[model samples]
Target: MIAHSVEDPLYYLHNFRQVLQWVEQRYADLLDDQELAFLQAFVALEQSAQALMVRMVMRKGELFRSDRLDYAEIGDTVRALQPLQALGWVREPEQLSLDQLFALLRKDELAHGFAGQLSRPRAAKSDLFAQLQGLALAPRPLAQWFEQAPVGILQWCLQPLCDRMRLLFFGNLYQDWSDFVLADLGVLRFEQVPFSPGSRALQQRSEVDLAMALHHCTERLEQGEAPAAILDALAQWRSDNPWLARRHGRLLFALGRHCERLGDWDLALTVYGRSNHAQARIRQVRVLERCERWAQAHELAVQLAAAPANALEVQALQRMLPRLARKLGGPAQPRRRTTAPQLIELELPRELAELGVEEAVRQHLAQAGAEVHYVENTLLNSLFGLLCWDAIFAPVPGAFFHPFQAAPQDLHDADFQLRRAALFDACLGRLDDGTHRQAILDCFATKHGLQSPFVFWSMLDQALLEQALACLPPAHLKQCFLRLLQDIRNNRAGMPDLIQFWPEQGSYRMIEVKGPGDRLQDNQLRWLEFCAEHHLPVAVCHVRWGGPA
Candidate 1:
């Protein structure tokens, strides 16, 4: 019998898949389009919940990190609710205070007996979503049944977010909410299931499954298992499960890396060739280089450099060329990148130089309600970060745009692009208001704690975030958003030095600080051009160091 730990994260993933299948098979066909809308909303929330849990667990055991997931530290359902909130998936509660409750109560002798009195409840709580979650377990017509339960207000409020949800996830089962009862929302699937003997064996049989093998490999790697033993075991696992292995390209790539790390160049080279990952092929070249197969490595490197697939690939080839040339005796190709910005220089009062130009400008912006913050580095960067977050990442899934582990990597596929663009467009509607502003503040809670991998979310404080969200024009930020998110790894840098935000006017400007000789960087120019294209206000504050000239 294959032995497996009962606590593996795959166990949860397996169950999450079960919920999806249960909903599709049992509920999808039978339900009316309205009920199907509810069904789809339910799946969006839980599917994302499951994805978050699995990502957290797998991320803990990735090769880059040494620490393992503390399963005991796994949080409550509310934690799952938080991510859903990011995508307009939350049901806000309306807590009735004592006076409000008293107002709702029927007139009674006891209530009217006292001339000057007020009624108060011993305990008050907003439990609408919690109550609705409990009620959804039963098979009933959601609208009629909820109205009978007399919570129509909650259902009414649910409509906006539900609409937003359908918008965010590419138009769920139907275009409109019909009045129908759902056959099953799979609430039971949300509960934990104890691992049985059969299931336990299933989770442990890495020899039979590629995902299981991956989980095991990651765990062993994190545990600092002997590399040879790990490699040998994975080799056998792959040989035994060739069919499954063929479907797991990433696993093969990872295996190649492990072998390369162990100095098993032949195994690494062979596995890397078999791995269908573009990066793996690049790795194979490096493995050949390590094995002193200089001619083959050099030839491969030259061919790859001629047609580099991505920025990372281009960089890898460029770096390797010089080293390879040192051995093979040839001149390496030098890549030139020209990214000059539209330069406009300004002259500031020489007396201000004593106070420092950067400081003087920062103080000037602060006088106009642009609070200087220690965002990524400064107040302007921090504000821009939040402005970007409110405009893009908060509304979309974290997995959708992150570089290392982005979701739905069909970047070229029209359907995926259209869906992403739709969400971006819907988000732009909130440009001049406080819509989802709080969610923006809360969505990156993990990042603020420094426990998340998201690049831009965690850097701003509430003060800066509030100011940024209130001040930045949704139109200008929206215009600049996609490019920044697409190339977030590099394009995130070079925001202007100061922002003049006016909350009352819903207006802001990007001010790039330039001393006598400094000019705008490429990323900054990109931002400036986007602003100018949109007819948004931006300026260059060229502060030269000198006395009054």
Candidate 2:
């Protein structure tokens, strides 16, 4: 690690001479002493180049790990190498594709050059439900295969090349399919790959333990498992789970309520009828209401509504009481949150500030006199979408395929993810490179209504969009992508309203806005955590809600 940190070009020039003098003279009997020492220095020097390149891209640091130098199937080798040439450490040796660059670097592997093929076998699925037959009925296990599967050194060295004949028939062998399933396929493609039955791979550490349990229970429900069986398992897991009482109560209440809605009244009563769990008793009020046990339902509803925790329970109790009062022909009035409803004008988008947090962050940083531009949200995610386009979108062969012009059964197919991936990548590449800006713009211009879940491409064009992307540190982009992949719905939505882009320094900060009474939502907290981890500047801007002008 210490050796890898010495990235300065001048240091390598000075150190190489010192290394040769120290190692060669000591191993005097060894004929290849000088060559061995030089090889060792070369490896260190190349690593320094990779490290510096990463520093240039990232604000703090981002780990881009590979099993070995040959793992280009995981990608970005040439992309990483190109920047080194720009840095002047590497003088472009007259031409070779990105794939060939790896072969050239690892010359110790004597072979028929780049023509040699990787020899790895696909591992059999080992999840509990792997034995179940049929595509629809086959249980899609919850393991995160992309993070867990290790592309071992032996994979490339052992076994016959996976579908090497594809290279002869179709020029591009799509060798990514042969090696590194994580690169060519999504985690959803395979069963959870664990390090051992009881342990998991290092990268899989980020996966949430809570999500694993929730997914397990949800899958059991979907598979038509008996409600009684699911309830028993939930009971067992709850005993060992580390979740707080409130959260555990909520989960049980939700699952019980779902079972109740599905006519599993006895199971629902068994689960949610627990008097100790406050939320469960509230749901039991509904179970009683559905069962036409009106007197009991109204009695519990009246008791709970006075201090109900969940909003739905309050509404349900409120709605049910009035009907109950009228049917029983009684004078007991239904309770309301307030005697008179408070009203406010519903007009929105008053545009008090052009970009609220952006303008605010820019002004705040400016007072300290920091040079930065506070830009709004669109460009940040657009650039992120571009960086991840191919990996997220490209369809891997045999991994998934869409049907011909029909509604897609295999959503994991490359084309679907590709749709947004290519659009975002091309859009960003055009803005940054200026090569196909017009063509890319034209493609998007024709469809004014087209909007991506990931990118607001309609608003972003070539020039300024690229500038915003360049300003953001690479660590920020990589971190955002990781968080987005973790939970697509929540992570995608809660990006800060403003980004402070320092064009001259090529850096930026994310600033989230909240009016006086407003608070950060769960998703916003997740984004803030991501920003903090990457050392990307993020702050909550408290805006004073000034009375109407």
Q: lDDT values of the candidates?
A: 0.48, 0.44
TM-score of each: 0.38, 0.31
Q: For candidate 1, what is the TM-score? A: 0.38
Residue 62, candidate 1: how far off, in angstroms? 24
Best by TM-score: 1
* Model 2 weakest lDDT span, ten residues long: 153-162
Tell me the tens digit of each residue's lDDT in model 2 across 1-549.
011113343333233333334333332233233345433544555554444332322221121223333222224554545544554433423332333222323332212121222121122322111221222232221122112322211111101111221111111223322122122222112211111212110112122233345546656766777777777766655332222233345556667867876887767877786424545676777787677777877787788868874333554566778876665568867565432211112222335445553464456556654444444445555555545433333333222221111111212221333435554455345444544334434534453233233445555666655666567554455556545544453346677766655677877656676654677775665566556656777766666534464
Q: Which clashing pairs does model 2 show? A: 366-369, 395-414
Quantify how close model 2 is to the true structure by its C-alpha RMSD in Å: 23.5
Candidate 2 ranges with C-alpha deviation above 4 Å = 1-257, 260-377, 396-452, 546-549
Question: Once superposed on the true structure, which residue ranges of model 1 sit more than 4 Å away at CA?
Answer: 1-210, 222-254, 274-282, 290-295, 302-309, 322-327, 340-374, 377-480, 483-549
